[model samples]
Target: MSSNLGKIDVEVEVKSPVDKFWNGIRDSINLFPKASPNEYKSIEVVEGDGKSVGSVLLIKYTEGFPLVTFSKEKIESIDEANKTLVYSVIDGETLKYYKSFKGTLTVIPKGNGSLVKWCCEFERANDEIPEPQIIKEFAVKNFKNLDAYLIGA
Candidate 1:
């Protein structure tokens, strides 16, 4: 009905502190596979100042048409101060129609617990918006995955 796509934003509260959760996410090699499996199939460090910004991280994510599965995403930017990891799509099936996707994971402190806000923005070429509920479903599942991982750690 609407060609303009809406944004998908989801937030989850973790028992862990902000600093701890922030550190966990900033470490892509350690946290990528666990926190987000669908997008980040795997992350491999290629070249850079090792651990610092400009480090090349080959990311394997969902790709393939008809039945999308996995592809590659290069680490475009990493900011530890704001606890943000921005990745640009290099090669992926999902990128074909989705065009582009920017994901951000942030932690906001609230008393003892912290609010883990995760969001993904996508650009669609067609007017096809596969069921609005799917967005909520994805958000819940993704956030739940992060919550479990944080609590267990």
Candidate 2:
């Protein structure tokens, strides 16, 4: 990584099947707020059909979520065969501290469950800015919550 760039990878092992977990992530616009209403206020597609590359999603975080009020992310790529999705923060309060930010999510099959991996690549605007550990924690929490939701469903 570059001097100003940072990368973090977080993983969560869940009881939900790989297919189920991957499906939930792909349909996050509808299931995220339902699974964790306290964390996500809403997620709406502002561009594209919410299913393809270049789709832009506006994600609103609930009050007291300890992060930005909202985020605008653009879908860069999706590989269904590999069960991976890549998105970048194009416009959001996160940009205030990050020169650039991108995230990639992948789901892998495990014994009767799934292992979800989240990788965040970010460039800080200044050295004083902290690494995005909060975001990584949030991703781990979201995966666990989503896993519960998928298992229940």
Candidate 3:
């Protein structure tokens, strides 16, 4: 199966400081399960020294889906100087539909708050499923959840 690759970018204005938003970005694995328990069951560090650049996160999903998907993301890069984070989905059910998936997050100072850009690049296994758009929507929703959780909004 062969199909063209796709990229999705979602940018949102967050009513939070860049430092605080960056902290939330770094703690996403632990915070996501707590904020969105319906979608995420748990996340555990399986490799490396935690959330650092080489670390791997094993994410378990909540029950009741026809296809239960587990996400294993490897932290590719973390640049605190630029407030940027990059991770790759090395394993999971998403790989069943995508040949590759890469997630990048950046926080830029905007006025008193911050502007967050969440981008995902994925190559589909075939043209059957629109995994790129699905992941994009998922990212946006999760970002909203994270923003709300961070600001207690």
Q: What lDDT would each prediction earn against the true structure? A: 0.63, 0.93, 0.83
| Cand. 3 TM to true fold | 0.90
Please give the lDDT score at residue 132 for candidate 1: 36
Worst 10 residues of 3 by lDDT: 60-69
Candidate 1 lDDT by residue in tens digits, 60-142 = 65542123455455556667777766655555565666666666667778678678787766766567745234545655665
Per-model TM values vs. the true structure: 0.69, 0.97, 0.90
Q: Rank the candidates by TM-score, best first.
A: 2, 3, 1
Residue range 64-121, candidate 3, lDDT tens digits:
4235469899999999999999999998898888889898999999998899998888
Per-residue lDDT over 1-153 for candidate 2, one digit per residue giving the tens place of the 0 to 100 score: 668899999989999988989989999999999998889999999999887999999999999788599999999999999999999999989999999999999999999999999999999999999999889888999999999888888
Q: Please give the lDDT score for candidate 1.
A: 0.63
lDDT of 2 at 132: 90
Winner by TM-score: 2
The numbered model that scores best in lDDT is 2
* TM-score, model 1 to reference: 0.69
The count of backbone overlaps in candidate 3 is: 0
